[model samples]
Target: MTDQAVAAAVARRFFGRQRELKALRADIERTGLDTLTGRKAPRARVLLVAGKPGSGRSALAEELADGLTDRYPDGVFRARLTEPGGDPVPTARVAQELLAALGVAEPPGAAEDELTELVRRAFTGRRAVLILDDAVDAEQADPLIPDDPDTLVVGVSRGPLTGIPDVRPCTLGGLDAKSAIELLTAFTGSVRITVDPQAAETLVEECGGMPAAVVLAGGWLAARPKASVADLAKQLRGLTGDPLTRTFLLAHEALPATAARILRFLSLAPLGRADAHTASALAGCSVSAAATTLADFAALGLVSAADDGQYEVPGHLVPLLRAQLEERDRPAEVQLAQARMLERTVRLLQSCRAVTEPEGSAARRKLAGLPRALRFPNRAAGADWLRSRQPVLLASARLAVADGELDTLARRLIASFVRALAAHRGAEAAAPELYGLHRLVLDVAERRGLHRERAAALLNLADLDARTGRTKDALLRYRLALDAGRAANDPYAIGRAMESVGGSYQELGDWQRAGDWYGRALAQRLARDERADQARLYGRLGAVQTYAGRYGEALRNWRAAAAGYRRLDDLPGHARALSEAARVQEYAGRPEESLRTCEEAVEWARRARDTRLQAALQLRLADTLDRLGDPAAAGLHRAAAERLLESRAAACEIRSGFEKD
Candidate 1:
């Protein structure tokens, strides 16, 4: 499928997160062409997206760029500072290119100051966007600066750009564990994430949310189908830098005398967050070696892996690699390697964040050439592979964030987990997964300063709680979520929270309270034309009405719900409606009609493989038989219901004479 189509499909997989997306969108909107420049009204806005490598700084920038590009008619100007082969963009050359993009000619081999002036003159009055990706210190971006008062300049870097004064800075961190796993599920599909959730959780811890490491581990696991989450986790735990093991070893060993020492010493980093000077100190090497190693690591896809000169280590082996690289047995002549590999890895991951997959002949070729283990054949196939590699993805995200590297990719990845539930595994079977993911995402979103995401996470968790019989807790969560939605200005989130509150009341058997909340939710949802959720709400409303002994009203709502489900071709919903109709007949003492309805429910349940529904219908059938005075036959049907309920642990339990078979 096309990338946009794939993205749309991926988007459809999310169960929630409307609140956060709305807030993020608002934030993007707040960042007007002039806003990043602040009150000084400098000729140009030099906003910097700063974070450790793998922190998803690039993704966040891309998100803003994706939404804001339309506002700038001069077009978005993007340039790669770090090349795959590990070359830094020369200041003069970069300036020349920027000038050219702005439709200005630069003097060939112009002096640094001249080039800088040339670039400034090129965008004197234009509303173009300049994205300088994979940047180093501010000095490197000096020549390529935008001069126009209407121009917005975005620079993505691994660390703070100390050289740039008066630039608006945002430090990115890793995705939340839940978001990371969700992204994994979204990319890999359901089969993998659902099989072993606990293992997946631990794996997310291991990788620590370094997107590059997460992606690498995911790619590795995806390359092998039968592998378990624990299996990949075991591998991550076992990664050590000693004895020249792992793909990074040969590269490390082959590094030039200066680069090798810097990299080796950087391995001592505890948190794996680093910069060139940090690497130099750890390696006992000079600044030059550290700089060279930064470029070298990018070429090897170990750190910058782009021209950005942003240094980072792979999250997967950060601890183990640091230990091995720091431990003794080094030749006196051979200096220690760097301590900043982890941060470099974070940066590389930031550069490599491709959510909807790559495009174009060049990009396709570039993706195709990614190490066979690294390249995903297609978005669908990649999603399938990613699903199986959830543990690794989570680990990567956690590592990046916990390292305190200012990466936000891990958090974004967590947001995508909503996709994992609805679209990846659907609502019914993936409930447990959805519950845990929402819990984690909620916590992380709040901690990462994402109020909108926090509300969405809370709402999502409340839904799960209500479903699983935690009505009181669900109500509290929903209330908090509603407050958060209001604070974040998310009307849709507020409506959803209202619905969840109503659902909690229904679950608690408080029909009046439930109806009131549902009414408000329905009104809001109706105004929004969110027909997607009408079927479910109507079905739930009907159930509440039936339980409250409003049979006629229940029948009306049930019929409407049934029609909605039929339009959607939802067999399970149809069966539920039929069963509800049967319950009304049974309670009204219409044995004949009840029996017919029960039979239809039974057929539908069988086709739907809904053991719970079948059990409930069987129990209804037994009750009807009892009404008909066939005690022996009633007992047989009751026995069958008992067997089904006990075996599958279906809901609607009854402590009848035949609770067990």
Candidate 2:
């Protein structure tokens, strides 16, 4: 079958639940449409499918959705309400997921109630089907369900959901004996069943009509094409313990040692879905070997191949695999697996940074020797990968924190996440992730007694706070960072904290305090021979001086900054310095000197390709010419500035429209 055909078949696979299916259809029709008004009925639009573990509730829900696709033309959306380990998924997160599927974006860190309202608004007039699978209880499902009668929600769980209004609950049991036999036949092919119908029936009876058990049994039989069905049935009949457990044990024991070990290690993967790269890390083997093992597991029905080329172990089987992993009790092996995964993540993140970082940057140079496999081809691909894998990376960082043994790895992971976020998404969009990562880094640093790391984390948090308009909070964090840096005896950290504190003070409009802090930072940079940092500090000092109405002091500082930038061969810095010097000259009533400096600034801006800077310089030159009573020259400069601004505005509008489209 084609892939679509196979997917459709899987969705429509209902062997012998005719009675339940009929009742479900009846309920959907009865509650869905209003005969009196010829419109959607005013009812709680929920169909609850309740069943035991491995009883195929999820499958039945999918089949029902497939049958009603024509009814819900907007689309069918699915989300798991429980984690792979059976823990309840957070309600806010479920709302976020549903809202995203509905093409509505909620703000970062939005409240649960806000997200719930957004979901409700999204479904207000939409005809959609929401299949919330593996739901733990009604509390988990309440906020996610839309109140719109036109929408339909299918809630699948291990038992009936309570507290939901007017829910039509369909409780399911295991498949019937004949249906179980058909399921096995569907998996193992009809030839084997036709060869020995009695043995197939016996095997179904032994499986107690459980679809999962029957599928695994069929997989076992399918793996051995020459083995007689009668012989397999006899072997099933001879098992001494629970049939499901025995079947799982038999399937697991039959695997080669390497494959079995890989399966056990996969139990540790978050969400029970792992790609070849993750499997390679977990199994401490080559990616090729891991890919082969994952494919083999998919063939054996131990896992399903996800659309993204990852493999997902069934939720019902995760507990069993975890138990088997614990039974093996190889702490050393588990530790090694974890370390390898962390290392692999680190290498991949390094490559992401390398691809996105500016050319000739220290960050790019540091990643020069990264392995080819981990490298991304371009910035766009790297950014796409980072966006797609963000959740996984976040989960891995949380896991590292909980484990505590990989403290260094956790710090590195969080740092890499911050860098990746800043590279792909700007600081504003990355604020929430950066906030979380900085907190995590602080936790790791404090636990490990790494004073320098703690100081760095504090500084980063302070910078984010300042950027987000929390100047007071930023000031507090900067002080803490400075204290920690002093304790660590790191001049660079101390200088950074001082400069950041000055920035916060400047944001608060405290020019005097800002100048003082800048002077202190400059002292440290000079003592450490950090010429680049010293030059930047000089510019910062000049800004505070200019704001304080000290034109002479500001001019002196700007001149020093220009000299420093020239020494460092920084064209943009020199241009900015020249612009500031011209402003000081204008304030000092030296129009001729200001005009000369402004003209020089314009040339430097052109060399730096900073059109905005050039535009500002032209305006400054026009102002100086106006003060000198040269109206004609001033008019020309003003015209040039207006043209530059118009062009910039047009470019911005074009970009904005493109983004909107």
Candidate 3:
């Protein structure tokens, strides 16, 4: 069949709701537009459609949106306010989705209030229809409502959404018998229904006028081309209790065992949505098998396929499936499924890090054994995968922790997430996720009595705090990490904590305390023969000394750092040390010495191919030359610095362009 023909066949037929539709239209006409102002009226008009599950509230709202497409010329925007499992969707997430739909670009970590304000501003003068489907309560719908009078918002929930004001409430129960029969005929074809009109009416009555039940029954009948309407009616009569539940059971029971098992496993998936990889992980099957099962379920009306290749079970059926799963009492099977999913996620995250990390790095080597399906084709695909799966990955971590029996998996998941995010999005962009993961790891470590892990988590959190400029908090956390490290007898952790503590003090302008901590860390590094760390600590200590006006001591430390880096064959480290020494020389009123040091630093930076460092050294050289009465040379250096900076900026822009794609 043609795409248009299929769409027309499945298109929602508005049946037996003329009164509700009329009332909704009247509400929209009365308050949606301000005739006097010739624009959308101020203060949004809300039409609330409240009904029981499967009562077609969302379908009704969509029908209304379709009818008013011309009135709201901007567009009709829709957002699901609840997950399929009936959890209220986080307002921040919903706000982000709406902003994206409105074509507004927001930062990845934007706060809820910021996104809400952005949504409001986006609809300030626009004429549009905003549909909040399956809202858990008024609270979930409040921030999403546009304040503009011209735009209309239709909120569909199971309750009245009483807390929201200026709402026109419409309560829906079920379709009348006539409309239900019509709906069935629309699905089963007019010829079949006309052949047995009485049986079709009996089937509609048996469905209790619930549209979802009627549709599922019709889909069942449509799937069986030779079955008469009497056959379905007789089958319906044999079932007892809620028609919807009975209908759901009938459809579920007809599935093959593997498909049925996959359906149950999907009940445990977050948001009731599963892609092929997720299905494979849950079902212990190949990706192709899982994909085929999901497609079959979609065809059976047991699930819906999204445009992005995700299949979601209907929200109303999630509870039923979960109840059935609970009754099966297969704890071991459930745990196995969870483990498989967690393990797959960890492996995928590892592959994400592998593709994004610098080539030939240890991290990349660690990910060598992953199967082809789990590995991304390139860094861009890896980054996109990480971005798309972040929510489900985070949900998995939360679920593992809550299960309590999967503490080890929880810790690994958190660590893998942190590493993958850092590699793909950079440290600053991934700071928030890192912060949360570190906290989770700390909890898990304490519970598992893993002191070393606890210490590492503390240090990681402190590093993030310092990076984000929370010096006092960083200091406190660093001290705690030091204590944990000592308790764990980990010399490396202790050294790292001491260095971080010193850095925090330096940021707070306490040079004396910074020097003491840096000295302690440097001693440990020296004792351990950690030459690279010692070189770094020398540069750190020299900067503190320079800040405290001990220029002579600072110059000595910087020279020692430069010599150590030179011996280590680290050109960038040597150049950075020379730059620090030059600053100390200038502070000590040694202009000629500082100029020579700056020149040497610039040459080393060039050898390292560090354009940014070269530009910085050129500026420093220009200052030194200006002080030494060489205006002509200073001008040349200044011009060189500008050109280098421009080139660096252009390179950064080009890299950013690739990242966006």
Candidate 4:
């Protein structure tokens, strides 16, 4: 269904909260509607729709937002401020999500404070409504509230945001009896509700008039058309505290044994959401069976089914389900179940990346051997699966690492996550999360005394730092990684760490130290006969030498890199190396020689089918020709270069459109 259709369906079923909605609307308009006037207040109006779990506060906030779309024409951006595990989501991550929802381009690799500031600035001039759900405290909500009076911020939290200035709080409780009865009538139909008004009232009382519990009771009653409301009320007659919990327990007791077990394991799902695969893995059942059970649960309001085919256990239901899991399953048994689910997740992540490999590649062959259900059909399909499942996949990694007993599994999970994320979303795009996951891996490695993995993790973190221009910080981590590499006797890590240190020094303009580190790294690669590393280090040395005014040495090193690429049969790499040589030739005041070299580099780039490289080389040729007193030839080359770049840009735009679609 379209989003509007779904929202309409929900609005039709929504009952009660009339008075609360009125109060909330009043509170939102207390400072006057932002859309009405151009007058700017000191800050955005913040209204806290405070309630306990199962109080329907989130729904109320959604209803209010839906009604106010006309008032906030700019947008109604929503963000969840807490994780499924009840931990507060970091303010920076929340801000990042908000920024995306606001159609703002977040600066990649930005610090937490910077992202928070960006989010605030994005909403400054816009007349919009920001719905922050499940916020735990003032800190989580405060950073997100915009300063513009033309905007409004509606926060759904457990209680008052104590430290937030001028915040209006609307605490909620049970729905009124009349609205409660009407809600029951909608679920079970008016005929049954009308015939037994006393029984319906008893059931409402038993549910404590909490909208969520009443809905559960009504659903349970509706499912058994033969059962009366009094029957459910009698079953709950003597139950103690928390009507929602009691109703959940009663509904759980009625489920078939397998369904009940699956329901209990649902609590183990990452972020309280599970699809058929998740259910099948957790319950040791077939996907079809799991899907059927989930559908039934959704019908009974035990879980909410999203359009994407995943079922979400209601926030109030998670604790109840967890309680059932603890009562019925052993600790070891629970751990095994979690392990199975995580293992299945890892296999899925593997498949998600493997489908992107060449058809006859080893990864593709391995994918073919997996179950048909696990294999994706194509690269696009694989990427889509990875994108859709990233949240759960990341959550699973966190849980695995925090499990503490699953260090080996956690390491494997983190590795697969890194590869999958990089395959689907480029490394630069996934760098922020990758940095954190690498830290988790480092934590595990340190705890287990695994020096090799420690070096690898440190190197990964250092590379991200280097990417973001933190040269000094990256150099420190590279040095530490080098130490770990030596301790582990990992030759590859040692070479990479040395080369990276040199790169950092080059970025910091310490040409002498950079050259020294590069030479040290070169020696190791040469001793091991690692041609690729030798070529890479030579290029690194060439760059530092060029920066240090050793043009002759740079030209020689670039030529050597070109030769290495030739031996390795890497056309694109060969082309790039030649282009570098041509640039250095021009820098050395040999324009005629540079012209000839650039022409050859352009041919090589064309042969390699590297459009951007060819265009760059063409531009270099044009510059050299212009310097050599050949304006006609220079203009011709310049036009050719423009055409090449335009084609490249157009191709990139097309590819980006496909990705977005």
Clashing pairs in 4: none
Model 1 agreement with the true structure over 1-661: per-residue lDDT tens digits: 4322332344334322233334544543355445565654555667777776555666566666655767777778876565322346567556655665676644322367887787777777778878888786677886677656578777888777786655766765556778768755543456887888878777666767555445444444543567777877776677763221333443344456656555555444433445554565556556566666565454344543312223555543454455444464363322222213333333323223332335765545555555443344555654554454343334334444554433354455544544533444456755544554566666677777677988988887777666656678879999999999988989978988988888788777799888778778867766876664776777677777778888777767777766777777787888888878777766766778878878887888878888888888888788788888888988998898889878775344444435784
User: Model 3, range 1-661, lDDT digits (tens) per residue?
Assistant: 5322332456435677888999988976664335555764457889999998888888899999999988899999999888777878889778877886797866433468888989989998998999999888887789878888878999999988978876888999889888898888766778899988898888888888888888778777766779998887788788887988888887777777788889889988866778898899999999889988887666556676766677777788898888878876398999999888888888888888889777788867766666778878789998887877776777777778768888988888888888888888787766666676787888888888888999998888888777766779889989999999999999989999999999999999999999999999999999999999999999999999999999998999999999999999999999999998998999999888988898999999999999999998999899888888999999999999999999999999999999999
Evaluate model 3: give its lDDT: 0.84
**TM-scores across all candidates?**
0.38, 0.78, 0.81, 0.86
Off by over 4 Å in 3: 1-19, 32-44, 63-78, 92-129, 144-152, 234-238, 256-258, 346-390, 413-443, 458-480, 508-513, 548-553, 589-619, 628-661
Local error of candidate 2 at 173, Å? 2.0
How would you order the candidates by lDDT, starting with the best? Answer: 4, 3, 2, 1
lDDT of 2 by residue, 1-661 (tens): 5322332343346677777878888887763335455765554478989987677888888888888888889889888888777778788777867876787756544568987889878888878898999999888888888878888899998887888867888998778887888888766678989988988888887777877777678777767778777887788788876666767777888899989989988877877778888899999899889998887777666777766667778888888888898898588889889889888988888788778878788867766666666778789988888877776787788778879898888878777777778878886776666776778888888888889999998988888777667789889999999999999998878988999989988989999999999999999999888999989999999999999998898999898999899899888789889989998888887878888998998998889877788898898888888889999999999899899889989999999999999
Cα RMSD for candidates in order: 27.2, 5.9, 5.1, 5.1
Residue 183 miss distance in model 2 (angstroms): 1.1
lDDT values of the candidates? Answer: 0.62, 0.82, 0.84, 0.85
Which candidate wins on lDDT? 4
lDDT of 1: 0.62
Q: What is the per-residue lDDT of model 4 for residues 1-661, given as tens digits with 9 covering 90 to 100?
A: 4322332253357788888889888887575443357556677899889998888899998889888988889988899887765778889878877876676766445778888888889998898888999999998789888878878899999988999877888899888889889877766778888888999899999898898898788778767889988888999987777899888888888888989999999999988999999999999988889998887787677888877778888877887788789899889888888888988888998999898788899999999999998889899888877877777787888888888998888988889989998988888888777887888898998999999999999999999888877778889989999999999999999999999999888888999999999999999999999998888888888888888989999999989988988898888888888888888988899877877777888898899898888888888888888888999998998899899989888999999999999
